[model samples]
Target: MNRPRLAVGATLACAGLLAVGCSSPSQQAAPAEQAATVNVALSDAGCSPTPATVPSGPVTFAVTNSGSAAVTEAELQAAGKILGEKENITQGLNGTFALRLEPGTYSVYCPGGQKDTWTFTVTGTGPAAPTAAPDTNVADATTKYHDYVVSEVNLLQPATKTFTDAVRAGDMAKAEAAFGAAREHYESIEPVAESFGDLDPDIDARADDVDDPAKWTGFHRIEKALWQDRSLAGMAPIADKLDADIATLKANVATATYQPAQLANGASDLLTEVSTSKVTGEEDRYSHTDLWDFAANIAGARTAFELLMPALQAKDADLAQQTEARFVDVTQQLARFKQGDGYVDYSTVGDADRRTLANSVNALAEPLSQVAGKVV
Candidate 1:
């Protein structure tokens, strides 16, 4: 019998190989029969066993990237929804993922600009085996959250570059305008930003974070230079540091792992930032761009909530619906303050409007806090 090479530390070997052909008699009787397995080879052309139709039941895909590309990922998708996937499958190496798929049509995606897709079918099954156990749900949510972080971080790099370029060029007017846009991208994924030690502070530290006035740096430090001093003469190095910090964050987010509870708490923490600092007009004190950061923080927190929404809905639909409704309410209230792509200056808002915005955010935060308990 032929045996496909197994990935490192693979728990289960390729299924359906006859014990008589490949294993000794003693080895054959040692372990119970395992689920069926399929060997999938990914290369420049695409996935082999193209249209890998298989039976519906417990199945393991033994995937190998035989292509020249440095990295690739294999995903099992059905109806445009990902059922299972493994990322960072390096060339010439193998990786495996198991799934108990229901009878249906599925596609294998080997994404690397190859545009490779292998459509297959899962036949014969009473019902698709439910893979939505607590642990699985948490794992799926974590993967999605990491993906979101990567996307936001990718966007941050260019946006920060634009802001920093303007600052370094001594274009204070353009730099001030670019500030809110760059900050928004960072604010949206601030939770993941906390992972890289000192990077977040290096990019966003406020004046009080440093004891020495000369030591203060990052966005707030630059903010003072633009608004208070009304100049960008000494901001070139600061802008360069901010750009470097964002580059560091982008690298770190690619491998970061998140726990479901942390995601739940992260959403709440973003709101806490809004209520304590953003709402009070403290975060963008000089630029008066607090509203931009406030909205960005909402976008980020909402992303965390949306990522876990599937698990939450499965665990408790009523609570999920309630939480979703609250989010919509807050969004609508925030929209009232929108002016073009940004919001009205923080100082322009009257006390009544501030109180109303505070109440809306608080209301959403209350139900949002229960997400971890419901999902986990």
Candidate 2:
């Protein structure tokens, strides 16, 4: 998040006024102690606190997970010191952490920079304890869904891996057959996607409309857009539209904002990689058929999110909003990673690249699921 610039006042009149006040002593009042509770969650960018407010003195933070993501822990930190933390927190929906705290400013943080953070200020005296919301029953919900997605991914993995391996081996026939089978498997889950939207849109989109057939194009929409015979001639136009959509989507999704120069720097580098890097295909990768470019893109995004996480933990919404812009950029490019470096055809890429892409996509499922789960 952006840090506020401190200004020094050195006017003679101002100095004289300060001196007068200092010279005149008055009764001092002791700072009052208060109590409060803060709710926190993990995100792709940083930790997030619901309500963003805490009472003074001996405050208890109750961190809760209301979605289908695995969050191992939530921690409270300040001044580079770890104040308190709850580990082995529940995953999926309804997991929580309760922390007792003294009145002060605290940062709520989660590992992996995958959650938003908040800085809560506790002032004078605790209020009467408020009743807690009943658990959302997220643990049970997460178990059921996690098992389902795992099963689906397992069923599709073999065929997809085969297609990717065939591509790497330059076996066109095998690649074609494997690609078709993988597509069918992914399509089969469309009806179940709606249930996973809270975890990952790609999966949710799949499960929501498998019956549509027209909608069950699998990953080909992006693949064809980037690698089809005519796609290159129109790369600029398509990339332009894609970039525009990314900006719009980021704007739609922004929920916080904070100090941005550093964030902007990271975002600039990320965008450059997308627009000029080999994986985005501005550079030739045929001579170097490795999928490192795709991997780098994912790493860059994860880095940007990490850089912005601290600010998010401070509850700097403005910072979160700005960082999210970059987040969207990275994720959008990631979604298209399959197309870069000739991996779109599924048969043209190696098994390793395919697996890497799948893992990257899967990591996003939980956070996206949580975002979608929020009514807002």
lDDT of 1 by residue, 1-376 (tens): 0001111111112211111011111121101224467787777766655337766554666778776483365656543433344444568766555544445556676654355666666776344333432345555776788788889888889998988999888998888888999889899877556434356667787876556677666888899999999888878898888888888888767765554645675686688678878888878889899999999989889989988787778767888898889889888988988999889998999889889889999899778866754543
lDDT of 2 by residue, 1-376 (tens): 1011112121111111111111111111111323245566654455677666654323344555544254445655444333344433445533322223324455665654544355655443432232333122222222333344345455655655565455545554554444445544333332122111121123212222244534333233223433343233323333333333323322322321111221222223333333333333322232232233334434443443444344343444554455455455446644564553234432365557545544444444234222211110
* lDDT for 174 (candidate 1): 87
- Candidate whose TM-score is highest: 1
Point out where model 1 deviates above 4 Å.
1-136
TM-score of each: 0.64, 0.24
RMSD of each: 17.6, 20.3
**Model 2 TM-score, all chains together:** 0.24
For candidate 1, the 10 contiguous residues with the lowest summed lDDT are: 1-10
What does the lDDT come to for candidate 1?
Answer: 0.68
